[model samples]
Target: MFLRTVTTAATLLAMGVTASLAQDPIEERQQIMKDNGQAMRVLVPMARGQADYDAEAALAAFVSIRDDAARFGELFPEGTETGGDTRAKPEIWTDREGFDAAVAAFVEDAEAAVAAAPADLDAFRPVFGAMAENCGDCHEVYQVPEN
Candidate 1:
């Protein structure tokens, strides 16, 4: 009897730890977006000629954004719309296909930017612009405007 009781308690404890390990989706998604934004800040100045372009830094930035974009759709799971101070729109759940397509496009653009490997500001401009546009397009329809 004592062994059975101890086993059940251990099982319950393990479940509690597992549940706590899962982040709230809204916070998780926001952190991912913030990380992507930080990566952009590293590349945008170089692309705009405001800072000297470093190929390695640019590649790293693209990789960061692409990695984050790859997981974008998975982060918007249902029931995550209103809580944890989310800026995600309800339309994300209703128009899931559109939301998903946008994420795919963002990922594609990031990959293209990485493959292009622009060595200078001029070469990087168009690729950077396209990626920025993808971000704006997704934000326009899926995210709530910040006050």
Candidate 2:
């Protein structure tokens, strides 16, 4: 009987841990944005000619952004307009159609960058610049300014 009780307690503890690991939408989206930022860190210096152009690194960054873009819209579910220290503007929920279109444009740009597979600095510049602009435009409309 004692062994069974202990086993049950362990199972309950494991379940609680799993539940805690499940992130709410705000947390999930924040993580996705953070990941995109990391990818940008990899690409931006090369774009600026501050770092050597690396085709492999550039492609990886593009892929990371593309993958994140694919799921980014889904992370902004109906009730996620607030909380979790979100910088998401209410415009995301209020202007859902526009927000979605912006996300679509970003996804398209990311995919194009990956497909273009820029092999040199000259080739990468245009593709990277376009994607960067997309990010800025979306943030202008959809995100609150950081304090």
Candidate 3:
């Protein structure tokens, strides 16, 4: 009886995970959008801080932003759920060509943003803000956070 109960519990857990994965792709995208936003929140402050001039801090923030952005792109094509967590806006799917262009633009902007980070810790106001703007444009149209 105990063995049966444990097996049932495990099966139920597996089903639950599958069910969650089947949830609207938009929901997953929303979560990713939120995560990206959170990461951005952490990064900008560190860069903007007076102490950000330190070599270590700037490098860390750049790496963090780049890594997070790369993870965000995972939801688009490379993910198991290509259709899942992809509140990429209906237009993106329908206007495939234009959408691809936008995504390319984002990648370029993000890469440039990270590259622009100075080795000696300089004022990254312009580049970082541009990076955020690139992300923001997509989120504005494609991502919606759940209430």
Candidate 4:
């Protein structure tokens, strides 16, 4: 139906409909990481993000990260775009299944990290560190730090 109308096709293409379907999962994963990273960076700096500072808002942020981290696993579907500038190393593509398992681990750990966050600064520190460690672990094995 969409292709039947030349005008519609043009509109869809302009709206970013042409190439995404053809891209592999890795590409999607990398884009997701970059996007999520942007969001995390922004939220982490806010005083309301810390439990000691604003327990409610900080918990909200933690919950968001906790949930998003799990969903993020879908973005890195192995060999889809691992060779690109993504922090993911090429080895990830070589062992696609393992890569996915790693993502699962991160998701689980991230949730724990978020859950561990307490309303105190001291408590929030370790919880947040856990979250960062999950990310760092992946980067160490499958990703390259951005220059």
Candidate 5:
């Protein structure tokens, strides 16, 4: 009986740990965006001529954004629109087709940037600008203002 009780306790503990690790969609997407923001930090200074452009670093940043964009859409599941301090606007669900298109554009632009593999600041600007525009467009329509 003691052995069986210990086994049950261990199983319950394991389940609790699993539940905690499984972040809600809002938290997951926020983390992904935070990661993308970090990647942008790596690229922005180089684009601005404040930091030396490194092909490897630029490629890695582009790849990160591409990867995030690929998975970002799944985080907006039906019930997640209004929780966990989400900045997502209702348009994200109401205008689902448009939202999906924006995500696709971001992914496409990031993939193109990665494929281009910009070797210098001159080469990096256009690709980065295009990807940045996609971000701006989506945020303008789909995100709530901080103020």
Candidate 6:
């Protein structure tokens, strides 16, 4: 009975440790980006005029971006550069200042997009385009191309 209890306790402890380590920085940041993508999807059809414009939805999407932007820097801590199928380019660490600036610019633009939330599909195009431009700029410089 004592041996059985110890075995179960060890198994439970190992599971706890595994769960804690499961979400490393790379996975955490990727999940954040995935969430951002989800928000963008909410705005895509409206921006293209395929769906009726919804100001509340547009603003909420922008807010999601803004919120994620604030946590951008924390997701790229040192030593997390090469692991777990990360697509982060070495340039992110090599040009840390530039990468940080890009993140800051994204945060600023995200906020601007939120504040300039469009009331109509026509108005949303430019605003969404500008925010997307920031994302593209960072990805071009910092993200590794997928094979």
Candidate 3 clashing pairs? 25-85, 25-86
Off by over 4 Å in 2: 1-22
Residue-level lDDT tens digits of model 5 in 1-147: 664465456445544643463578787787777767777888889888889888877886787678778878988989998979999999999999999999999999999999999988888999999999999899899999788
CA RMSD of each candidate after superposition:
12.2, 10.9, 11.1, 9.9, 11.2, 11.6
- Judge candidate 5 at residue 132 and give its lDDT: 92
Off by over 4 Å in 3: 1-35, 46-55, 68-74, 77-87, 119-122
User: Deviation in angstroms for 103 in model 6?
Assistant: 0.6
Candidate 6, residues 63-95, lDDT tens digits: the string is 767877887787898998998899999999999
Compute each candidate's TM-score over C-alphas.
Answer: 0.81, 0.84, 0.55, 0.60, 0.83, 0.79
Clashes in candidate 2: how many? 0
Per-residue lDDT of 20-117 in model 4, one digit per residue for the tens? 62365555555456544643553466534532254444555566456556666566553455355566677677777777777787777667756776
Choose 4 or 6, whichever is better by TM-score.
6
Candidate 6 structure, TM-score to reference: 0.79
| Model 1 spans with C-alpha error above 4 angstroms | 1-22
- Between prediction 4 and prediction 5, which has the larger lDDT? 5
Residue 37 lDDT (model 1): 75
* Stretches of candidate 5 exceeding 4 Å from the true structure: 1-22
Every candidate's lDDT? 0.79, 0.83, 0.55, 0.59, 0.83, 0.79
Give the local distance difference test score of model 1: 0.79
Q: For residues 1-147, what per-residue lDDT tens digits would candidate 2 score against the true structure?
A: 664465456445534643453478777677677768877898999998899998877887798789778888988888877778989999998899999999999999999999999999999999999999999999999999888
Which tens-of-lDDT digit does each residue in 86-137 have in candidate 1? 8999999999989988999999999999899888777788888999999999
Residue 79 displacement (Å), model 6: 0.3
Worst 10 residues of 6 by lDDT: 10-19
Deviation in angstroms for 37 in model 5?
A: 0.7
Better of 1 and 4 by TM-score: 1
Candidate 4 ranges with C-alpha deviation above 4 Å: 1-27, 42-52, 82-85
Model 4 scores worst on lDDT over the 10 consecutive residues at 10-19
